[model samples]
Target: MKAIIVDDERLARKELASLLASHPEIEIVDEAANPDEAVEKIEKHDPDVVFLDIQMPGKTGFEMLEEMERVPQVIFTTAYDEFALKAFDYNALDYLLKPIQPERLTESLNKVTIKSAKSEGKDQKLSSKDQVFVKDGDKCWFVKLEEVRLFESDGNYIKVYFDKFKPMIHKSLNALDERLDDRHFFRASRKHIINLGWVESIDTWFNGGLLVQLKGGEKIEVSRRQSARFREMMSL
Candidate 1:
């Protein structure tokens, strides 16, 4: 995979680049000192991944991603642990604390390879058995699609509800909806998408909508426009 190392510290960038050199799959296309340079290099090279630093002179790494029209897989390399949660929230490929461990770097690279293989077919929707990498602050999880009960939109982010944790990801609900299998996941409303398998009960709600209670006891309202479709899908 084509890659780039972006960090304010020259030594940090060089060290990462040196480590990456051992991995034949990752080819270093370029390097950037800050977010602006990173953006320019990224756009020019269209690399498969970026080893990014959170703190920089101009814009932070997260800000850099927000500004990009298309974001590549990101592997965060930072000295601070505070940004770990936010890094995962963006569904980054991995988070490596500096100075990065060789074992951890290998694991992250493996994950990237797996992700690449899974996404080989552009039209293939993600299945319920598939695992998605999620990070919230310092917490991280490899959550299965089947365990996810709901996806709620919060501005530009999507709050994922699964098990007892609700971690937010930096992705649009609509974009996620397109990648999800319609047979297992349904768009309940403009702000929410729900996993059909987790539905515990259904009840009529106001405005011709329907209220769906998940196994976890969370109640989500299916919009009036989607109610009929939901019933049709659930009916035997």
Candidate 2:
């Protein structure tokens, strides 16, 4: 994937570039010294990812993101850990502390590669076999599609229910619906998409809707508009 290193220190930029050289998947397309320069280069290169420093002269990394109309996948390269929690709120791909560890960098790159391929439509659909890396705050998980029981939309984020943990990831419901394998998952309502394998019971509800319960004991209302299709799929 194409990338740009945005840092104020020349040595810091060089060091990161050197480490990235060992990873064949990452191509260093450009470098920038400050927020202004970074913004200009990012628009010019349209890189897949940006290695951003949290602290810069004129602006912080988060401020830089606000300036972009279409922000790409961001991997924050900073010396502070305090901003780690806030970084995920921006839906950053990963957080790499300054003087980055090679192992950690590789882990972050793996996630970026998986996400980048899916975003670029290199993968038509994600099946039950596909694994996704999800990060909420400082916690992270590599979960297979089959393991998720429900996806509840909350504004711009989706609450992903898997096993016993419910973690939120930054993504829109409509965008995710297009990529999911319909045979294994169903969009039951405007706010929910459920895994068919987890359904435990189904019953009639108010206004021609259906009340569906999962093995995990969570109840979901299948919209009146979607109930017919749900019945058809279930009966099939």
* Deviating ranges (above 4 Å) for candidate 2: 1-11, 30-52, 55-75, 82-94, 101-148, 151-185, 195-208
Clashes of 2: 0
| Tens digits of lDDT, candidate 1, 1-236 | 88899999999988998898889989999999989989889767767778889888878776776565445677888898776765465445688999998899999888774234434443567778665666556566556789999999999999999877898888999989988899999999999999999999999999999999999898999999999999999992
What are the lDDT scores of the predictions, listed in order?
A: 0.82, 0.82
Worst 10 residues of 2 by lDDT: 114-123
Task: Tell me the tens digit of each residue's lDDT in model 2 across 36-131.
Answer: 999888767768778989799979776676544345667889887776665454334688987899999999888775333333334457777555
Candidate 1 structure lDDT: 0.82
TM match of model 2 to true structure: 0.55
Total backbone collisions for each predicted model: 4, 0
